[model samples]
Target: MEPADAVTPVDPVARIEAGPEGPQIGVFFDLDGTLVDGFTATAHAGDRIRRRQARIGEVTGVIEAAMRYRLGRVNFAKLLERAAGYLRGESLADLDAVGERLFQERVQSRMYPVMHEIVLAHQRRGHTVVMSSSALTIHAEPVAKFLEIDHVLCNQFEVDAEGRLTGRIARPVIWGKRKAAAVQEFCGRHGIALQTSYFYADGNEDIALMSLVGHPRPVNPRRELAAMAAARGWPVLRVENPGKGNHGGLRGVLK
Candidate 1:
């Protein structure tokens, strides 16, 4: 006798409500370039700073440091520290206020629709979604809240008792290998298994965390990451550039 076919319901609400039975998996996403377009918040903030004609010297220093950092000539942490010096004595609340403006005006519009759908898909499967980045709390927090992500793993700057910036990072800057360590530490604390975890990133610096995860998906990857993904037979996801005539389209390269 033939067995009866099982039917699966197609209700989105039900699917999201129905949590998985087995151990939960971790889904880590790199913020800049991966989920959203590159450093939109920072760019907007810089523009605002420039318009105010304040801290011109610090701004110049940061620009130079950023150039060197991009060329792989300076320590990323040192660069970040030098950048933080720009915010020295600035009000934390004021920073967040500007960050909100930037998020709305520049960052929100650039977030990839495809990536948002992917995040929703993982959430429906009862997996933890984490927004991991080197972006500071002021920038990353609002974005995380908007996305309804379960957790945020990112760098944070030190604040004085009165809630002013101290020009120092609260934790070891979360970038490159430091990001991998943060993921590992989180997994250990939360009882999530690394072998079953998934990571999505676009930068070469994220290669450490990518290698550690069971599933590594590259989104709009740069040259180094593209090469690595291709050689490893990993799937590469390219979300369409909305402003560049490709709207809501997706392409897979080196799949």
Candidate 2:
């Protein structure tokens, strides 16, 4: 099916008109706020680095970028770039270890049960499930492993022959439009139908890819995302944090 040029609303859990055993379809998910409340592993990794090296400027940049990201003013590419730069001379292996530790310490507990259930449902239905994010490989890989997702489309850092980080990001840094492009490429390679695929995300930056999918579900969306979801008639899902109970009102609207 051709990619849609217009935004269309859809039920979050509506099934396609396929039979018990249907054609191949893909279910894409955004990493940060959609599947998990937020991605704190990156922050955790950076903090770990800062504790040893103590670069105030780098730490401050991270804080500023994070704030901008939370405000929806910073896109994933920019955020990933900044985060990668902080580990300029660090070893890739060390960063990978830190990434795993950060995932277990900070990110593992933040996953939403509702989102996990949705992933399982799609898996049982034989859909290809993928985690797409602008987060670097170090931060995204562990989470994908924990979720048992086999495919991932995310940003990566450039490393030297010696396996040291070069403080630069690999090409096509997965962000807004770039992320949409990656999903399209994946569909082309796997013979999946874009018109029948699903994409669930929470960030406003995901609109490009979300619009391309047949079903776009916004989970605990931000202000702009919530407004767009309502305007487009896209389904909105609310999942409480693992420990937090029901939080009502506008604040709850944007998790």
Candidate 3:
């Protein structure tokens, strides 16, 4: 199924509660900047710096790669590859544990309270809740576990037989169109209908997938996303970064 031909003003939760329910309805939420206040990549980088997990040169290289990516000189995949090179031999098991600890210490508090309510509302209706994030499994899985999301679609590292990172992603990167494709594939395999699904996200690139879903809820959206939502008459929601005083709180125009 596909998004409706005609869009209208409606309450997001009410729409979900009153719409179709069952395994066929998918409710997807993006992690960083949507479900939570900050980017998990930034948090992971800071944690590495504090723990001295990389040599000075390695740190510099990763930072340079990030800058280049930001400057459009490198793609997201290359940036991740450059960063993964820093942890070439690190065991996935160790990183997974670190991810759990990192989320508890750094990310748990940043979750938007209003988003929690939205998630629960979907759950109560027995809809399939999925975390569709561009973050690495190391960063995404912990949050999914905490939220009790039924499925996760995220980037993964290619590992050696020793279960150590091979300095590359195992599959396609979960960003923009690739992310949409992954979700589409999942829905197709599971018999979920996109027209009966809802997706909440903040990135401009997410518009690709947002266009495919029936209910597109743009949360704390980026500039382009905001403009697109406005033009399309999609609901826009904003959740401020918590604990930052004026920087924290969620407000949005559902209409």
Candidate 4:
């Protein structure tokens, strides 16, 4: 007689909600430096920066300015416009393809397993998972798909009919308050309550989003964010070098 089928197919969404009795939680994660160790897309963009093939530093400077603006020190619109200007005149297909290739080859491999497990654990607990990044949507979307994230909040580029890049953002750039805006819109559309959500990020630029969530945690945070998180009494997680047995709170679940 044939043996009874014993394998069970687990539902990721259901698994993500298996935590202690409470309202369903939504986990929003920042892509660079939070989920992953570094900025892969930015590093790839650096190639164009170094070659002067593009005004990458100018764009980056604007990004930095935008971060500062989020901290209430500058004009956000001006910084965004300046950043968009740097990408003018590029072929969208070429830039996107190059970025995708570089990201898959050099960046994807460096993903920390502990971080991956944390994402999965949240998923298994039935939490709605989102990947929010300052990178262009072309890059962030693929990474989101690869990680099976439920949603993505990222920047979009305008492309002409000929597939050439107009170097203008198709929508408001997703960073800082823009990120918080995107999250708010998403929650509104999905009927999700922001008061019960969670957000994880590592940089000073993400403070707006961190403040928006009910449960905010800083994971592998930068020095500035670390200080802020401590002052706010938020949890700080360190997952680097999991093999050496330093996974922090993730150890129990991982084992």
The candidate that wins on lDDT is 3
Give candidate 2's whole-model lDDT. Answer: 0.75
TM-score ranking of the models: 3, 1, 2, 4
After superposing candidate 3 on the true structure, give the runs of residues whose Cα lies further than 4 Å from its correct spot.
1-11, 245-249
Candidate 1 similarity to native, TM-score: 0.87
Compose the digit string of candidate 1's lDDT tens values, residues 111-228. Answer: 8776787778777677878998988888888788888996999988899999999998887889999999999999998899877777889999998898888767778889999888
Per-residue lDDT of candidate 2, residues 1-255 (tens digit): 222323444323334323133437888988888777777555565566657674778778888997998777987677877877887888989988888888887787777776776777787777888998877788888888988899999888899999998888999788888899999999999998877888888877788887888767778888888787767767666777774754311122211
The global C-alpha lDDT for each of the candidates, from Candidate 1 onward, is: 0.77, 0.75, 0.84, 0.68
TM-score of 3: 0.91
lDDT of 3 by residue, 126-179 (tens): 988999998899999998999898799998989999999998886788899999
lDDT of 4 by residue, 76-161 (tens): 45554565567677777777777677668766765667567767778766677888777776567656777899688887777788
RMSD of each: 6.5, 5.0, 2.8, 9.3
Error of 2 at 141 (Å): 1.1
lDDT of 4 at 179: 85
Top of the candidates by TM-score: 3
Candidate 2, which segments miss by more than 4 Å at Cα?
1-23, 42-46, 68-76, 245-255
RMSD of 2: 5.0
Residue range with the least summed lDDT across 10 consecutive positions in model 4: 1-10
Pairs in steric clash, model 3: 240-249
Q: Please give the lDDT score at residue 210 for candidate 3.
A: 94
